[model samples]
Target: MGWSTKQIPSLRGRRALVTGANSGLGLQTALELARAGAHVTLACRDAGRADGAVATIRDQVPDADLEVRALDLASLASVRALAEALDGEGAPLDLLINNAGVMATPERRTADGFEQQLGTNHLGHFALTGLLLERLKAAPAPRVVTVSSGLHRIGRIDLDDLNWERRGYKRWGAYGQSKLANLLFARELQRRADAGDLALRSAAAHPGYSATHLQTAGPGQGGGVGDRLNALVGRVGNVLLATSDAYGAQPTLYAATHPEVSGGAYVGPTRLGQNRGPIGEVPSTRAGHDREVARRLWERSEQLTGVAFGLPAAEPVAG
Candidate 1:
């Protein structure tokens, strides 16, 4: 039988940090981990929303050990602050889930002046992982799970125009690029870990087409024509072809705790188009598997975010 959340072994004494835990897949993932006996930190931008999410989790799992911290993924300063706060706490992080992201939003600049989606989805998590690497490494069998998306297949990493400043941005394209970046970062981190002989394990997961606030939370949060259209599509998408948020979070939970998982593995739903079903290993895009591309993206990410990998460099290859 396939493993579900119930099958997950007790995570007592484990410490977990989940980004974007205020809603959607992040919130659900954090709650499930908490239920499994892990002390979870809900890293979110809004303190009020995070408190509410914690309350909801506590309502169901009265003993849920939860902490809410302010983290704006679109801002580098916020990322740094969050990292510093965690480091100051001096707690070992067993699992770090990079679950926060933006999808299909209008062109906007982040606090760091990068394109909004890329900034929040990729750079923010990139820096967070770097900043928290020490605590993660301190934990026994430390794992870093990054939540990507199926749209990664359609993504192309534009090295020159990473921020979409020169080229006009399309909502889906930007979102796809960020998701692809997530996978690439995971792969590259795995490579670095292996090359440096580090104990940390890095893997990636995709929720597939789960009914989440991602669509509406993007441009739709403001209430406009695009928002209305996105909301309509979201409703139709959920009805016609999408999984529940609970099901969507399966891959992430699996990636974080599955004993059989290895570094660089990608997990998602097992079903038509990977939209729904039990969590299982899935094939990644050729781009996602390209070691050279992964390395280059890693370097660029480090440079853009000003966060070093803190691991030995991988063997350079001809591009």
Candidate 2:
């Protein structure tokens, strides 16, 4: 049988941190993890929404061991602050789900001066993961699940114009690049863990087409007419064809909990185009498997975020 959330083993005593947990796939992922007996921290950018998410989960789980913390992925400072706070807790974090990200939006730079989509979706998680490596290492069989999207196949990582300084920033293309980076990071992290003989495992998952706030929030304000129209089309598509957030979250939950899932595994829905269905170990993109690109991206990410891999820096060619 295919993997399902119902098949998740007891996560008692495990500590998990899920970014973007205030809504959508992240919220559902956190809620299900809590139901499975894991203590989950919902790392979000807004406090009020986080609190609301907490209340929603408590209404169901009632005894859910949960915490809400501030995490603005667009700001490296905020990412570092979250890492520092977790370090202060001095507890092992068994799961680090880099589930926060932004979709298509108007051209904008992050607080750190990088393009918004790439900055929040990829760079921020890269830094946070590096900063929390030690805490994850302290746990038994630690796993990091990076959420990506199917649009990654069209992404081209313009090393020269990574921030879109030269390329005039096509919204969808930029979003694609960000999603591609997520997979590359997950793959490279797994290779690095193996090179260092660490017990930590890293994998990637895609939620498929799901209806969530990311659909509306991306084009609510500041985004141009093109983005707004895009959002309108997205809303219609989601209403007609997209799966629910709970169903969309299954791939991530499967990747996080399934023991049979190996490092560098790419999990997604097992239907047409891997859009929506039960979770399955899917094939990664050609770029996602490129060792050369992953290496350069890793180095560049370290320079951009100033957070190095916590393990003995081993440069391994990911196959």
Candidate 3:
């Protein structure tokens, strides 16, 4: 009976772009937005699969407004390509769901040489958001929603060795860092917008234990017995505990559409361990609110991604 998709405001004439919209939570997010009358672009890594996703959506909402664009968050060039293409189209984008991501995965680097998790989950979205800032600003009211995770509670950001070059790599730790960065980046963006007097709303959300391919995608990559066990565990968890992808997506939907949702808000399930339930404002870790750390991470992200947000620097507050 809490805030569900039924409360979503009419999105007529609003244009939204959802990353990784080919399946799982991303697809669910895209579908609901389309149902609410938004012209949705499904930016995905695989073109064929994206087509299937579009078809699946159409099957449910026959007149759904949707398009598929190829996007590989593991590559900076690919992120820029999609942003530039949208720029060429010269249409304002009202909603941007930075939802595409990889969970715990084997040690690997993106095309830009950053750790794959941080690159895809944080840096890639960082670049895309910056590159498309103008497009967003063109709209009367613009919002960006970045998806994080409950695992972020344990994340520690190591600015000096963010790519994990100096220390030994831990897959879960890397994912935690990326998800934590999502929350940090979201707040920083809002701070910058307020400081610059820009009309932009930035928010973050986490799908509390959603049954998606993300749980198994990473573990399924290895051929070892441990990997197989991990994959089996993920599948079991999906069936036994996790909520449906559509249900998990409610937080993101609420964060994206709820009129009362303010800038810098972090939305998540409001139940046991924040894993599943009605959506509401949830507190992030203490680290997620460290202004100085968020500022530093923002600068580091720009340096690593080579994408400037082009917003004014926040003035120092007088004591």
**Which candidate tops lDDT?**
3
Which ranges of candidate 1 are over 4 A from the true structure?
A: 219-227, 316-319
Model 2 regions lying over 4 Å from their true place:
310-319
lDDT of 1: 0.90
Model 3: lDDT equals 0.93
Model 3 agreement with the true structure over 1-319: per-residue lDDT tens digits: 7888988889999999999999999999999999999999999999999999999999989999988898999999999999999999999999999999999898999999999999999999999999999999999999999999999987999999999999899989999999999999999999999988889999999999999999999977668888888899999999999999999889999999999998999999998989867899998889988888889999999999999988865665566
Tens digit of per-residue lDDT, candidate 2, span 104-137: 8788999999999999999999999999999999
lDDT (C-alpha) at residue 308 in model 3: 92
lDDT winner between candidates 1 and 3: 3
lDDT of 1 by residue, 4-52 (tens): 9988889999999999999889989999999999999999988999999
Clashing residue pairs, candidate 2? none
Candidate 1 at residue 92, lDDT? 95
Between candidates 2 and 3, the lDDT winner: 3
In model 1, the worst 10-residue window by lDDT is 214-223
What lDDT score belongs to each candidate, Candidate 1 first?
0.90, 0.91, 0.93
- Candidate 2 worst ten-residue window by lDDT: 310-319
